[model samples]
Every structure is written in structure tokens, then in C-alpha cells.
Target: MEKHVSVKMINRFDTCSSWFHHLTNKEMSVKRLYRTDACGNRFCPICTWKTAKKNAIKISILMEAVKEIEGKEFLFLTLTAPSVSGEELCDEIDQFNKAVNRLFKRRNVERVVKGYIRKLEVTTDQEKYITEKLYKRKKDYYDWRGLKVGDPNPTYNTYHPHMHIIVAVNKSYFGNRDAISKSEWLEMWRDCMNDNSITQVDAKKVRATETSNSNAVLEIAKYSAKGSDLYHSEAVFDTFYMALKRRQLIVYSGMMKDYAKKFKNGELDRFKKENEDEYTHLLQSVWKGSTYDSKLRELTQEEMEMYNERAKFIEEGDEVE
Candidate 1:
């Protein structure tokens, strides 16, 4: 990260979550606030894990709610296209996204799948199409491939961009004659892509089991791209940065859209309170959960003295790390 990001970013990472502000209300309920670092991208393992976990929770909420409705079916779908060179990655991603849009718009797809949580994942493979830094990408704003005419990043690999979608439909979808079988899914994808040769897809009905749901959710909500791929080389990192920087990795549509919007807008009130930082102080918190364990009551004489000293330093602009 230091090599790729600015010095300011490095400094932010250094102090991130180092001193969490613990806030207490009149009721003595407490919540801790951790500072967000500049390294909030997928490259940061902390942020990636947090994001994956958050998405899992969000999906769980949606799925659990959807399951309450009668006659709902869930399908885990994987759609793929052939691997592309780094030089063509951006265009390929654009095309893939457009193809997905077209597929969703098709009458057959829209008629069956009422709701969906769509996620895009990109993986790199060196074994199949392994090569050196031989291909020069059309655009390299950072010149990650190096300035020298012959010199480039250490290695290069082909990229596979695919979709992991979880779609919900009515129960009749399984029995309907026009139901989307594996071959039908492939046909739809192939037609949408306008490529007859491209035919890689995996679609399966998800059993309404806790383990099955958990597995499907994890597969869909896990990191969009691997951290290993990002750190492979400057060239590879740059390719990812250009290809995915501003793109939405996960999307919620149709029936799922309202739930996602509710989730995002804090209809889920815990989110607003939990994520918002009503920064208080270097809280004298031995307080555990909502019970207000130890920190809620009056402090001992020694504890009071320590708190005073700390508060004094803070007021004097001499904060102790």
C-alpha cells in the first residue's frame, strides 16, 4: 500500500482505530467509534473483511425476510465469459455489465426471477494463459508498468470476470414448462452477449436449509476481488484499479431493491446508531453490553484521578497515544 498510495494514506492507516471513542448516553448505554482509514479499499484486509461481513448480514436480512413470503424460490447463479487480457479488461467489464442488463430485461428472465442480488467477481489465472509483462495496456495513468521501453511489471495474467447472482422466484418456476434449465440459462447469456461460442454458466435451486443459505450467501457476499490479485504486481494492481475503481460490485434489483434501500436508508435503525459516531472521550469503559457493567457507576478515587489526568492532557492539546 505504501508503494502504491500517497504518504498521507500511509499516515491515516498508521493511526486508524488506534484510539476508539467510547460514548455513553444518559441511560448508560455505550458504543465505541473507530476511525476510518484512507486504506478503505478492497486491498485493505480489515476493510475487505468488514465489507464481506456487512454484506453477509445484509443478505441474511433480505433472505430471511423474503423467505417469510409464501411460494418463493431461490436460485444461485454463476455466469461467466472467457478470460481477457489486461489490455481489454475495462471494455470486457463494460460489455459484461451490459450483457447482464440485457439478460435481466429479457421476458423469460423478468417473468421468473422477481428479485435478485447481483454480485460481480473477477479472478486472475496465470496457469492457463501465463505470460510476462509483454502486452502494453492502452492506458496506464500511473505508469505502473515502468517507463523503460522494455521493462514492465514482473508478471501478467489473464482475468476472468463473472457474476454470482442470487435470484428469488415463485414456486411455480420449478414446475413451469418454460423454466430456465442450465442449458436455457446458457442460451440466454450467450444471446445477451451476442457470442455463440461463450457458454459457461452454473445455475441451481437453493434448498431452504441454514447451511445452504449460509454457503450461498458467503459465496455471493465475499470479497469481489481477491487481495492476492491486487498485490500481485503494480501492473496487476493498476489493471484492477482502472477496471473496478468506481464500479458497483453488488447490486440489488426488483423486490430486493426496496429492502436494500431500507437497509441503506437506516430503516434498519441499528445501522444509524451503530455506525454513527457520537464521539465522547477516551471512555473509562469496563462497560460490557447494554447492562452498563462497571463504567456506568461512579469511578473509584484512583480511576477518577487517572481520568482527570487524561482529560487535562486532552484539553491542553497534549493527547497521550
Candidate 2:
């Protein structure tokens, strides 16, 4: 399955670097380093990596900024609804977002859970996630949570589209008479969605003692969905791609407004710049986009060497805007 996905991805991004200009200065001396054009296709693995890293850094900084506030606690919440076919996938995602926004706006909810960061995630139905473990001999490879699988195809069966939210709450929340219980949270979520048919909602405290690696905030700060899952079926991938067309994957509330602005305004070192002399001469290897026995191949060795010899490096201060 993974192999098939890789083949498809490589083919899809075969022309990613079809055209690129070497980093150069006003003097036209190219730097040793070069960058490929990000295709910006949502399901494209390469583009997704670049986007995820940028989001992670932004989220981490926001989390740090808010941690200094008193009475702050984090909760890992999962909200889900019934699966939808390819036709309904896009609509369902929009509805999901609306319902979540409604859940947060409720008077009772705002008193306790003051702020939140929500991320959308999708996984293969139960059979693909659960039963596939039989193929692995190592027990550690199995998913121990014992989650049930659902349909594999988005066109026919229900495809799982859910949100994993890192909710911030006041430390004194439980002391209030109106504080909600775990079950009540689930009920409220169901009611907000206006559909009591699907009953899977989770809300749990994310302890402050937890390590950054295990912290719920950092976990959901990652990619919106697994790349492998999107590779399952083109129909499913298309469904998600269309649904998330203009959607914001991760969102922060209240205190994060200023932090978001700073990050977006280039106040952060989102992308590392290579020192001027990191490499006097660097090899530039890219796909030629020509077919070789029905497979895309990198530039020939001679082509790479010739290009490297002609490229010139410039001083750091001379970098072009």
C-alpha cells in the first residue's frame, strides 16, 4: 500500500522542480544552495512537509506565550461525526466546523474552556486501521487502543473526518456549579451538531506535567492528516482536498492573535538561511521530467556536474530580494 502511494506521489510531483532559479545576489552570482518550487498541492507530500513545519513553529510559539497565564490548563478533545461518502465529504467538513464554532460559543462552555486550538484529522475506517495488523508479526506494530474500523472507500462507505482540539481551561473550572462532566461534554457536542445519531466525542485533561513530545498541543500541532491515509483512495483524497480547499487547519483563539501576526510578518525564523560559504560549490540534482522505461529519473550525472561547474557563489550580503 505504501509503495503504491509513493509511486503515485512521485508521479504527481514529477514536475515540481521543472523550473527554478538559483538563489543569487544583485551581482547575479548564484549561491551554492538552490530551492525547488513548492507545488502547493494539498495532498502532495513534499508541500505538506514544508507547510506542517511552518505551522508547528507558529503553534509552539503561541503555546509558550499562553502558558504564562494563571489558571491555564490544557485538554485534549476529539469530536467526530458519522462518516460521509465522497459527495458528502466536503459538506460534512464544513458542517463540522460550524458545529464546533457553535459548541465554543455556548455560554456554559465559554466559562470553563476559555481558549482552544483545533485540528482536523482523518483515518481509514476500522477494517483498514485494525485488521491490517495481522500482516505484522511484531506485536508492537498493532494499535492497542482496540478502535473499531469503518468503511475503506469514501465513495461508498463512511469515511472518518474528525477534529482533535487542544482546549485551554481555567484551573478552577471544576469548582463551578455549571462545570460540565465528560459525558455532558459529549452530549453537548452531539446537540451542537444537531444530530444525536453519532455519539463519539472525547474530552480529557492534558496534564501540565506531560513532556512536550506527549503534550496534546504539540501532537495536534502536526499535520492535519496522515499522508498514507490519503493514499488509500483517490476518491477519498479528492473529497478531502476539495473540502479543505480554503479551510484553516489549525486555529488559535484570543491571546494568540498578536503571536499569529508576528509569525506571519516574518518576525520568526521560519525558514533557515544557509551561510554564504556553507558550500563553495553544491550539486543541483532535479528530475528531468522525461520518461525512462515509464519512470521519472533524476538528472544524469554528467548534466549535474556540468551545471555545478557553471554556477557561481556570491557573498551573503549580496543576496537578491
Candidate 3:
């Protein structure tokens, strides 16, 4: 199974510990907290749903930004190569970026369609297993006795690790046109992929079978506060939404109980509702799932000491225990 970290679980522990520390020392104060859910599937549904919801919000934000810049055409591209170790994969990604930049410069289309490389990482073994399960199948043969079981479907051993690119094209370049043709765009994309010295999957084939009409939007949504599948087909969104909703409800109940002790029930409910509504709207926004770097600021002496301690521990490869 794919391994993923659980941000919610960690935060839960951290919050409890912080509260305990606060009780012991009245002067103790809480610092800014950021929660990152582990990508692994082992975490509770609460964490997963929260992560997914955040992703949706991020995507919504990005879409809004893109919409603001009028006359931009979006293209979804994939670059693939043989699977390799994580370090090598990172290097390849850097090289691919340089190649893309060079190709765009030469074509004088750099400004027209800028390429954004979102994720570049080695595919996990678990992902490979799942892919195999979904693609492979047993066969059957027609015979006098009706249908007879045949040999297993042939499996392709050439599994290529791939990266996805989302390119936004300036609509001004295609002046007076709604969008570029699939074949024309595919040819350009193929050439760009080849120029980057990256393995190119057949864009035409993929596009032909793509179920979603807004592939670029969906790609961005995948990384957004809500999950990518949320914007997929209605059926898929319904199924995923229901599952996640149950988890969120449980978490909400716990949060309500925790707050009830400190504040009036009506006031606590209002506060919770406000947060929930804000988060919901954020998910619906165009910049659904994205992170911005925090502004640089000086750290206090105590903060510096804590940072140094954490760094030393990390460098020594020692757990807090």
C-alpha cells in the first residue's frame, strides 16, 4: 500500500500537548500552526477530507486567477520516462524544465504559452500495483461449450514514470479564435516534449479517451484544496463527496464538543459555522489548492533556539523520543 503521512493526527497530538503545556505554564503561548496531511492512505478520514477540501479551495483560487487574465488557452501535457530513483527523477525534472524553456524561447511562444511544472517525483510501487490491477484482465474464448477461460492478458513491462505539465496559452496569440485544434496543439506539444529530451506519450491518444472536457482545469483541481475528483464527472464527485462528508461531520462534532466547554453553545456554534462557511467558499474559489511562501521575518531569541534544536535533531537523524 502507498505510504502517506497524516497531518491531522500529528496536529491533534500537537494541539493536545500544547494545551497541556499551557495549563502547566500560564505564560506559554501558541505559535502559528500549519497542518499538512500525509499523502498516505493510513490516516483517518477526517484528515483526508480536510486535505481534499483544502485542495478544492486552492484549485478554485487558481482558476479565478487564470480567468482574470483574459485570452488564455490552457493545455494539458504529460512528460514521461523510465522510472528511476528519486534523486535521478529530480535531476530529470530540472533538465526537462530547462529544455522546455529553451524550446519556448526558440519558438517565440514562451510568452504565449508558459509551462508550469507542478509535480515531479518517482511513482510509488503501490501506484504501480494499482495501475496493473486496473489495466490487466483475464480473457475468455468462445467454444462449443459456450465460453472457455483463456490465458491471462499480456502485461506490458515498460512502465514509464511521467510528469504532467499545465500550459496556459495567451489567447491573443490565436487572435479571434476560440481555441486551437486538438491535432495542431498535439503536434506542437509532441515536438516540445521531444525537444525537452523527455519521453513523450501520444497526446492524441490520451485526449481521445479523456472523459473530462476540462482536463486542464481538472489537473489544477487535483492539486487544489478539494480533491481533483471533486470536479470530475457528477457520479464520481457525488461518491467522493459523500464519503468525505461523513468524515468531516465526525471531526466537526469533536471540535464542537471541545469548544462547548469554553464558550456558550450559541456562540461556539456561530464561530464554527463561520469557519466552515469560509472554508466552503474558499474551496469554491478559483485558487482552490495552492501554497504561497510566507514573508520573511526575524525570529525571536526563543524561536531561534527552538529552530536550532530541531535542526540539530534532524541532522543527527534522531527522533524526539
Candidate 4:
């Protein structure tokens, strides 16, 4: 019997490999916070968690500056193309990124889109799973070329690469002459993709105002692909790791570029000043289902004392590593 396995679910069977946490207390509030350093490696699940937290902060800061503009709005968009085999995976991502750049350059899209942040992502359709018995019984039938799975085409069981973009547009864009509706956005995406291989595409307007909610923007800033989705298959992992080598996974353009520069110039102080009563700290966490366990339970007396000492140093203007 052919066993079905999910590429996305393989991480459920794996445990967190790294352990180290840091905590901090709010300046004017009693709230405590925790966070950890992210290695920023594409294949590390533990680091993926940390990266998501860091990215959320970054996107939030950007949105803070964005909301300052009078008529600007945000749109969360998912852009996709045809799935390609492992061999073609690397090149396809490059093509997809180039196409996205071209997409923004178009008069129709450019007229409405004032700025954007884009990230690349990938997924696989797990066709079949091989059992030890089957491998031993028909050892000659399997090979690294994906032929062992029955398809002679070595490129079978391909990787699906796509982009999740957060676009900033003028509030008037929806009613403008070049305004793109949900359906029109998809068609424009296909036209930009410029490949017969592309058949499925999607985009929708998301709430990104000052009052509604900003979680949508934060979600768009998360990792290009989940660690769970990439860690199961060696072919997928290696291909992606090499393909994205030296590639900029996230990009910001237009007025966003200016804001990003300000952020790089230590704009974190702005966030701290704005949210003085909030705590931002590190934690030792275990990845659960949808989120990680970040709440600090009970602390030993010694640990509590150490935390207090560190907090005192931070309040005294001494940098704590």
C-alpha cells in the first residue's frame, strides 16, 4: 500500500533542537517579555520562530510610518506560478522574482501601488511515501532522480514557489481609472508571470488601516517558507538553500525604502518611546501547533534575583548583551 505523507506536517514529529531564552521587563508597566536570537538560517525550525517575531516587529514599525500617510492603504497579495520539478526549482524562483519586479513596473499596477514588501515561499505535493519493506524489495527501482517513485521523469514531484506581498496603495486606488479588482489582480499577475506554466493565482484586499488591525501586515513579513515545510525533504531543502543564496528574500520599495533606512538608523527607539509601558523580552519556547509556548512559568528565587539585577543595569543606561 502506498502511504500518504504531508510535507507540511513532518515537523510535528520533530522536537525543538535549540534552547536559550532571555527576558526583559517593561519600563513603566509590570509586563514581562521574552525572546531569543534567530540564526536566520532557512532550515532551522527554532530560528524560524525567532525570525517571525523579529519580522513582526519590523513590519509593525513600517506600518506605523505607513499609517502616517494620509490616503495610503495596505493590500495583502499572494502571487503564484506553475510548479516545477526539483531540478528546475532554483531557476523558477529567480524567474518568479524577476516577474514580480516587472509586475510592479507596469503602468496599470504602478499607478495604484505606491510601495510593497515581498517574500518568496515554496511548498511540495507529497505524492508517495516509501516503506522500508518496499525499498528493500525493489531497491533497484528507486534513485535520487525521483525515478524510484515510478515516474521516469526525474523532475517529478515538483516544488511550488510563490510570493506573499504586502502592497501599499492610495485609498483612491480602488476607484481610480487603473484600479484593479480581485479578479483583475489575478489576470494582471498571470500577464506579468508571462509563462504558460502559470495557471493558479490569488490576491485580496486586506485591512491595514490605523484602527482595524495590523496582524495581517505582520503575517506577510513572516518567513518565506515555514521550517516545517522545507525540512522534511532533502532535495527541497538543498535546492532552496542554494537557490536563495545571496538572494534578498524580503524587499521594500518607494517611501517604504526611506522608512526602512530610518529603521536601520536605530528607529527602535521610536517604538520604545511609543510603547514605554510594554515589555519586549526573549523566551525559551517550544513550537506547538500554530504558535510557540512563550509564557514564562515559575522562576527560581536565584533566577528572579538575576533578572532583577539585569533589569536594574538596563534602567541605569548600561547595555546588556
In order of appearance, the predictions have TM-scores of 0.68, 0.64, 0.38, 0.66
| Model 4 alpha-carbon miss at residue 207, Å | 1.4
C-alpha lDDT (0 to 100) for residue 126 of candidate 4:
47
Q: Score candidate 1 by TM-score against the native.
A: 0.68
lDDT of 2 at 151: 22
Across 1-321, the per-residue lDDT of candidate 3 in tens digits comes to 011225764555333212110000112232222223233231333334444444334333333334343333445555455444433434544555555455446544454454332332222221222233333431221232243334232222222234454455554534435444555444554565554343344232223133232454344334212333234345434433332332321111122233323233333222221111001000111112353333233445575455434433121111111
> What C-alpha lDDT does candidate 3 achieve relative to the native structure?
0.35
Error of 3 at 169 (Å): 2.7
Candidate number with the higher TM-score (2 or 4): 4
- Misplaced by over 4 Å in model 3 are 1-52, 68-71, 85-87, 114-117, 125-160, 172-215, 221-321
Most accurate candidate by TM-score: 1
Error of 2 at 271 (Å): 16
lDDT of 4 by residue, 177-266 (tens): 766777776777777777654555666666644323365655565676666656667766676666665778888888677777877786
State, as a TM-score between 0 and 1, how close model 3 is to the true structure: 0.38
Candidate that scores best on lDDT: 1
Model 1: how far residue 250 lies from native, Å: 0.6
